[model samples]
Target: MLVAAAVCPCPPLLVPEVAAGAAPELDAARTACSDALSVLAAARPDRLVVIGPAEKAGRGTYPAGTPGSFRGFGADLSVRLGRADGDVVAERELPPSLAVGAWLLERVGWSHAPVEGLGVGESLAPERCVEAGREIGVRPGRIALLVMGDASACRTLKAPGYLDERAAPFDAAAGRALGAADIAALEALDAELARELKAAGRAPWQVLAGAAGNAGLSGTLLYEDAPYGVGYVVAAWS
Candidate 1:
């Protein structure tokens, strides 16, 4: 299976600006991701599979891209899904971590799954760009799943704390605005997703560890983001 993989960041695809330094933190991330994708592609899989939030779904449960369809990101990446020509679709479901995040949102507390709610964008989007690479053959153990999701900070439910002020100025307040309820929701999602993706039965599919990315924009909604977070994080089933 081409086995190509991409980092699963939360938004804007990481500002290129935050990734610079002597050690170059983001550089290392980019390097690892680039290397993994290259390696996977070389081995060859029918196509690469990435787990991203699709516009078609909401933050309720683990949702996968509609089978036999592709979600293309403009001027960015286009994700190709399903082997409709044959019959091989992802045998698994959305991981447990993702489920947790959604649950928390509906609850009264924060999920803490490291959510990066797009202050500007409508919502997290579906897989794209990475899948545009040329198709290769399928190869097990040849796969490498790099990950990077939303930034730790976000505009999810803006709130510093219960006792703190309800609102603040600029995007900085986004972090503060997040309440315990929001944190709980994010945690639930991450936890559930991490667990589901780590299934031992799915070998060769390394679930790279990761942390949240992208602090989101200056507003308090999840839509129309330009480009902010995007990087590979740690994984599961490694």
Candidate 2:
């Protein structure tokens, strides 16, 4: 079952190299993410799954030691999902979203649990996401999740999707739901509306809601902000 979870926004700007001189803008969010991961480590789960958005649905699993790079984002930096050993095996590169998750894992020196990654498509249906979440919940031994995705990208005039009048209310409701561990509300988030607002977190958050099941996890909103015009949220559930 889901023992714990950390929700983090997946912007490449979270990386110091990518942010460069503006790196300090996300310092608080980074700290919150670190604290959330500590809670997961403290839970001492048998398995930790990192979930994030990708270009396609049900993409293949990313095993431990998988590599991700930010060179595409103009940063000559790379990271591995787990510690490297001589037993290196070839693997596909992680999507940008999962790459950020990998960065977070590396930042925390995550060695407390075996790690794996699941990449879900942004357009995936809520039911499918929930089914996948249920299957993950039933896996043997305790499980923790590091969910990565961003909220509305249309929060401000300079936002990626350009100022959408509905973005603020949408993000506010989402933040409230995540902070309250209101699974029902999360599950009920309208996919169509989310798409319009360019909220990439919809599918992954629904999966989280499904994974939590009826387990009654309590939640805390660690951080919430709109930096670079995109809504970023850091939250923890236990």
Candidate 3:
């Protein structure tokens, strides 16, 4: 069962080197992510799974040592899911979102548990996502998750998806659900609407809801903002 979970936005901008001169803009979000990770460590979980959105080519499981790079983003930096025991080569590379998750894990020098990665597609069926999460939750051992994805990419005219009237309310509801750890609300989120709003977190958040079923977790919203018009939220559940 899930002992603790952290929900964070997956923008490469979270990495200072990737953000370059704009790094200070996300300092608060970075601090909140660190705080969230501390809760997971305190839980003393036996395993840690990092889940995030991925494209068709990136979907699937990734081992602990799976490499991730930010070279495409103009930052000649690389990260791995978690340190593997000597010479454990990964089968495939991590997706962008998982790369961000790996970066966060490395930032905190994580060593409390064995780590792995799962890449969920943005267009995945809600039921399937939930089922996948259920499988993770039922596995033996104390499990922790670091979920990464953005709420919406259309909060303002400058946003990636451009300004959309529905963006704010959708993000507001998502933030509320995450902050309250309302599994039902998360599971009930309109997938079609989420697609229209370009909320990349929809599927991953739903997966979290499934993993947390009746786990009696309480949540705290550590951060919420729309820098660069993309919704970034950070929350911790324990």
Candidate 4:
């Protein structure tokens, strides 16, 4: 009897003082994320494993985590976190994150990866959300998975429309006009990612659309009303 999930929003780039002028929109995102985190904290997992690189780690010793590593979220609920520190996860045995990464690599190409202190790294495994649940010994009916990444990791603050990298609704026509390749890259990445997550054993899977690289596109948000950014929440029994 465990079913709760939330899809948090992803602004273009969140700064240290996220609350200075990030009211309303950021509040909504926080509320959404807090609800999901509460469910996660209540899961009572042996560990909370996150497959992400260290945000402020160095190029040599890494920040503070390793791939397939473990960490303590708190006394109520713990998690096993995974990070590469200064390097990328081994392309093959990156555990539950490889397949989705492969799909993105095949389409978006590595040139678009947000490395170091920039965009969302190739840390999220389409199946890692499942892997996390299973690793913590959470029963099939009591698990929560969160998949987060930079909504628009391709464009620049110096770009035409998104001059400040602020998260906003993307106009479809303007997006499509930017370039088909970029749009295809993100779409392909997200589509395959969603499918992979669904197949990873998270029934009732839900994908919260995201927007991070739409300024370079050539279309307007018409039917797909997915907005400028996307967030996905995957939850199911172990």
Instruction: State in Å the error of residue 141, model 3.
Output: 1.1
Better of 1 and 2 by TM-score: 2
Weakest lDDT window of 10 consecutive positions for candidate 2: 82-91
Q: Please list the Cα RMSD from the true structure of every candidate, rounded to 1 decimal place.
A: 16.5, 1.2, 1.1, 15.3
What TM-score does structure 1 among the candidates reach? 0.29
Best by lDDT: 3
Tens-place lDDT digits, model 1, residues 1-238: 2222333333222323222232243444334334434443443433233433333322222223322111121222122122134443443333322221222122222221112221111132211111111111222334323233432222223311111221112122222222111222232233223222221111111111111112121212211121221112322221
* Residue 68, candidate 4: alpha-carbon lDDT: 25
- The lDDT for every candidate, in the order shown, is 0.25, 0.90, 0.93, 0.27
Candidate 4 per-residue C-alpha lDDT over 143-224 given as tens digits, one digit per residue, 9 for 90 to 100: 2333333233213344332332222222232223222323233333342432322212111111111121222212111111
Best first by lDDT, ranked: 3, 2, 4, 1
Candidate 4's error at 171, in angstroms? 12
88 Cα displacement, candidate 1 (Å) = 24
> TM per model?
0.29, 0.97, 0.98, 0.32
| Residue ranges of candidate 3 with Cα displaced over 4 Å | 57-59
lDDT of 1 at 183: 22
Overlapping backbone residue pairs in candidate 2 total 0
lDDT, candidate 3, at 192: 94
Which sequence of candidate numbers ranks them by TM-score, best first? 3, 2, 4, 1
Please list the residue runs of candidate 2 whose C-alpha ends up more than 4 Å from where it truly belongs after superposition.
84-88
